[model samples]
Target: MAEVEDLLEGVTVRLSAAEEIRAKGRRRRARGRAVRVGAGGAALLAAAGAWMLLPPGDRGTRQTVATATANPFRTDGVIQMPRADELPGYARWHWTESAGLPAGAGRRSGPLPQVGLAEACPASFAMTDEPGQERYSLLYTGRDHALAQYRVIAYDDTATARSQVAKVREQMTECGLRAVPPTARESEEGSRAWSGTVQDGRTMRVTVRRWNSWVSVAEVLDGTPAD
Candidate 1:
């Protein structure tokens, strides 16, 4: 029995070691996401140089553009997410264009100003509604075309936004679809946002999150198409 106990102890140590190795592998995988080209720094330098060579004031023209409130932006279902550590196109956009902004909203909208995040297009879009009343929609190409991926941002308090969310879910149910019930452990990100899932019997369900009055939905539309 003593020998058996010793052997089990050894096994436990090996299992702990294995767990540590697996955790390290996961960290490495997360950091190495996507592929790196050239020597990293060199590729960035080339990209910077190309950007600088563009016609003077070209950036101002490119950024003043705005995608409509309802037009679908991504046929391919991809949005260029803004990185926390970097400046997005909002810097180039004209914050002075507050013509149709939502109520209580300043000239500046929420953190993300682009609702029509392009899939194949690289154009920048602006949040044009009034302050605190700004509304925007973002779509991403899912794994399948039948799967509908929608991310909507509406600037309003929690109750107002929640009611709208409920209404949207109700409509989805009428179409034989389900706003995927979130898992028990699902968590929120801030005072204004939460994430959930919805499904229509497809292999992939849309995962959605609302953060700081902005809503983001991501899904792969492959197995089943949107009705």
Candidate 2:
């Protein structure tokens, strides 16, 4: 069996390469050159960039934004996570730095963010390039106990977002760490929800939804997770 460290290393390498690509992209945008050149490429870029300009209410479908109470901002690289008052039990949410992940990669504590999920089941669930991605978790203040996590990823198109959601649904079945009964449902037309337990025995309710070209994943534990 592959060790967790090995899997993390692989993810780190890929993320590093992705960061380089994004950096180049930033420079290109700085020069004010067309992001995608030649033959209808401009049209494609327009479509991809349109999501960023959409108003909060116009961003999502009939389904609410996954487990989040608010719509995620479309600004690239800016993570607008739910605030303390926004989350009933959580006093505050904090950013977590994962081992082997590039400083640019978004990560947090709570219910094992996306990087942790990839480490747990590398073959089944792995990280991929995105226009922008971020993770956040509830701050563990030692007194108040709450386990909640959130990840938001932006893609170039809705198709890519849909594909990610499908992969997550599939992971719920393929990964053997599942302890909680895997229940998958479409809370609304364009949203999905799944509940399962990780190896540490945290019963988590994960909700996924896509709006335009963005996808959000929220994980809220049924109770305080094992320490």
State every prediction's TM-score relative to the real structure. Answer: 0.29, 0.42
Instruction: Tell me the whole-model lDDT of each prediction, alpha carbons only.
Output: 0.38, 0.49
* Tens-digit lDDT track of model 2 for 151-195: 666666777667766666666555443324323334433455666
Candidate 1 accuracy as TM-score: 0.29
How large is the C-alpha RMSD of every model relative to the true structure? 24.9, 28.1
lDDT of 1 by residue, 89-186 (tens): 12322112112323321122122322111121112122333335444433222222322233455556756555544543443343334445454433
Q: Which stretches of candidate 2 lie over 4 Å from their true place?
A: 1-72, 75-79, 88-146, 175-190, 222-227
Worst 10 residues of 1 by lDDT: 115-124
Clashes of each: 22, 0
